[model samples]
Target: MKNITCLLASILLAIVVQAQELKLKPRKADALGGTAFAHSISDSTLSLVAREEIIFREIKNGNVPSFLRKFQKIVSKATIDNKDYELVFFVLPDYLAIGHNDDYFYMPMTPILAQKVANLLHCSLPTRKITDLIDQNATLKLTPQPIPPSKAMTTVPVFITHNDLVKQQMQPYLSQHANGALTVGNKKDIVISNKIYGETTPRVVIYGWHQLDGKPIQPLYNKHTNTWADYSHGVRLVQNTMWLNGKKTTLAKILADPLLSQLLSDEGIIEKSYYPVFDNY
Candidate 1:
């Protein structure tokens, strides 16, 4: 009896360790600004749908005539049993665009991708469970509706600072906008990009998401400091913002910044701008 108790404890410990070690880094955002992430039932989880394709220029002209048929077979095999992974094809004309009956990552149904996925899953046996879950629970588990900007009175300011690596990453997007303005109601926001000023110069961007709208809206990210005013019901409110290095706290601090709270209460931007002074180490 004691040996059995010890064995049970060991099994419990193993499960605890496995749960602690589970981690996933979301895939970088796709062209549409959507990042791919996932949750799983076990360590042995397999991707349900994956998009695999060869570019035309990557293949010989004559190869397309023969390779096209092979591509069809690959898709057919991939879709069987509602393969769980999703594949997005950029190819035009005959590109298999979406999934058919598969439990794909993004919940919304894209007919092209969906039909292709259905075709592929029609042949696989192992993926049937995912397909069945998708059929039964899809309505509940599919993509969540976005929250409207007006209702999101609680604005979270995420200030990314002191990271040369991250600034280098955002340069491309900033160059495109170059102070281009995006307006939400009476408020107009600008996009700023830079290559220099690693210290204290934090870039900022705002994302307005709507729960009922899944449209991709541009989100601003920056390293240097910037400011904006909040006006509601014909009143102007002001706020000074800064970065707090605590890993997951940026989102909350921005919304509740003292300056923002005061501005909203006062009904206007501050007559005197307050710089969030940070001490250097």
Candidate 2:
């Protein structure tokens, strides 16, 4: 009985020693942004040092494309509950953007880049379990309605072509218009490009023509720092004002005319004397 008691005491001492040794180490913070840390899970500890070092090495080795590197920015870093985390933002060439919070990483890339990152990290991507829960709990009803007769509709195609061609087309109207007036297509393209380049003060992305559910939507990228605004409404309101009795006008004519600019300024879409500010950081 004394031998049995000794053996149990030894086992307990060993367990206590192991528990004391299991500790998390603070990792080096990235200069651009991101704090490195060791995460303890069950019997194993995962180090971000290995993952981060690999990324930097690959980048230095020129493994990542130059275009992708241009949009990569370390937005911020923070320490929470004795653990450090970094928020890195990336705007891909394909217009797929990603950002992260402490609890979750949000990526519009969905299956493509998200899967690739998951593979690199040797982790599985998280599914929308909350969405599943909502669907399971909620009652959905489907009702059939009478189908209306389809009417023949004539659609006018809008073209965004060469700059020279656009300038040439607008020459007739240019003499009457202001110097800085831009066509509808030009305005839309510039704003979308600005979002991708992180030029916007509170980054905003304009959906491609009829991209989201056949309707255009402008969504803010930096939701944490920026308030959600309906930019789509402002864009549509300006476009409607430019239209003459719902008839589409030529790009050159629109650019050459001061009426569009006046209307846009009046509607608060564009400032009276607007200047584009480029963000260097």
On lDDT, the candidate that comes out on top is: 2
Worst 10-residue lDDT window for candidate 2 reads 152-161
> Once superposed on the true structure, which residue ranges of model 1 sit more than 4 Å away at CA?
1-32, 35-126, 133-281
- Writing each residue's lDDT as its tens digit, candidate 1 over 1-281 gives 97898687657544532332101122222311111111221122321122111111111111111111111101111222443322111111111111111111112211122222223322111111112221222111112222334522212111111112222433554432222211112111221112112346532322222122323233333332332311110010111111121111211232244443221112222221222222210
Residue 134 lDDT (model 1):
19
Best by TM-score: 2
TM-score of each: 0.16, 0.17
lDDT of 1: 0.21
Candidate 1 positional error at 7, Å: 5.9
lDDT of 1 at 114: 26
Q: Which stretches of candidate 2 lie above 4 Å from their native place?
A: 1-202, 205-209, 217-259, 262-269, 272-280
Cα lDDT tens digits, model 2, 2-65, are: 7898687657544532332101122223311111111111112322233334333332333321
| Local distance difference test, each candidate | 0.21, 0.23
Cα RMSD to the true fold for all candidates: 25.9, 28.5
Clashes of each: 49, 1
